[model samples]
Target: MGRWVLHLPVALPRRVDAVVLVVALRDSLGHVPALDFGEATVSAEDDQSRRTRVWCDARLGGGQRCELPLAHDGGCR
Candidate 1:
């Protein structure tokens, strides 16, 4: 399939709330092979193009990537 973005609007007024929702959604949908949780991000409603990644997403090796939080300390998973 080609690349595409799915925008799900959250009416919550806080960034933390929105981030939590997205993380929850990712966990629930983790079973889908087509979904790349590492690529997950959140952006302000006024600027959807400017994204803040939720995960470190650093390339580890052999088609694998770091699954830790973006600002996580210690080694990447």
Candidate 2:
């Protein structure tokens, strides 16, 4: 199955900062089983090329998603 996309309007001007904020929010709300933090990504308006992934989001055993950063070295958790 494919993943869903959500566009959130943030007040920050920089993409890096926006990603940081997003990761922080996801981590703080980690207890929420409904939130898929691994699939989180940030992008400029209407720019698919600039779409930056905030997490690895790789599928693991036991139906779990990787919580590491995008393109992270080593193994997924």
Candidate 3:
């Protein structure tokens, strides 16, 4: 298994907008690999330190749905 990082940038709340997360993967051939998108959760804390945590429990394979958290580092409850 390889390591991948997902980055999200959004304006501080109290502003009306939508967060967009694009999930993509590349193969060994340096091409967009067929992703087997599975069930996952992205969470952030409600307290001061908005540390985001992501949890993935499903088998992945080419493309997947983006599950964004409502807060940062609240421990994926």
Candidate 4:
């Protein structure tokens, strides 16, 4: 189990209905794991910076499931 704090910078259109943040995790076998984090909503007013906290569980059968120095993919929708 590990905790990660990410600071994200978001830019929104002048006129938009809604914005969302998406995060995805993959394991060593290129398999998507059961992630504890979900999509987060971003308001138009939140144009500057956003702070996100994530918890990851890399344990699998008493060993590490994912590769070392894990990389995360995050995007705004």
Best by TM-score: 1
- C-alpha lDDT of all candidate models, in order: 0.84, 0.79, 0.34, 0.37
Candidate 3's TM-score reads 0.21
Report the Cα lDDT for residue 53, model 4: 25
- Candidate 3 per-residue lDDT, tens place, 23-57, comes to 32212222434333232223332442543233232
Evaluate model 4: give its lDDT.
0.37
Question: Mind sharing the TM-score for model 4?
Answer: 0.26
lDDT top scorer: 1
Instruction: Give the distance in Å from residue 10's predicted Cα in candidate 2 to where it truly belongs.
Output: 1.2
RMSD (CA, Å), each prediction: 1.8, 3.3, 9.8, 11.7
Candidate 2 local distance difference test against the native: 0.79
Clashes per candidate, residues 3 or more apart or on different chains:
0, 0, 13, 0
Assess every candidate by TM-score: 0.80, 0.74, 0.21, 0.26
Instruction: Report the C-alpha lDDT of model 4 over 1-77, residue by residue, as the tens digit.
Output: 99775535456564232222233322232343444233233444554355332322345555444322223454221
Q: What shift in Å separates residue 36 of candidate 1 from its native position after superposition?
A: 1.1
lDDT of 2 by residue, 16-51 (tens): 898889878986988897776776767776674676
Better of 1 and 2 by lDDT: 1
**Clash list (residue pairs), candidate 2:** none
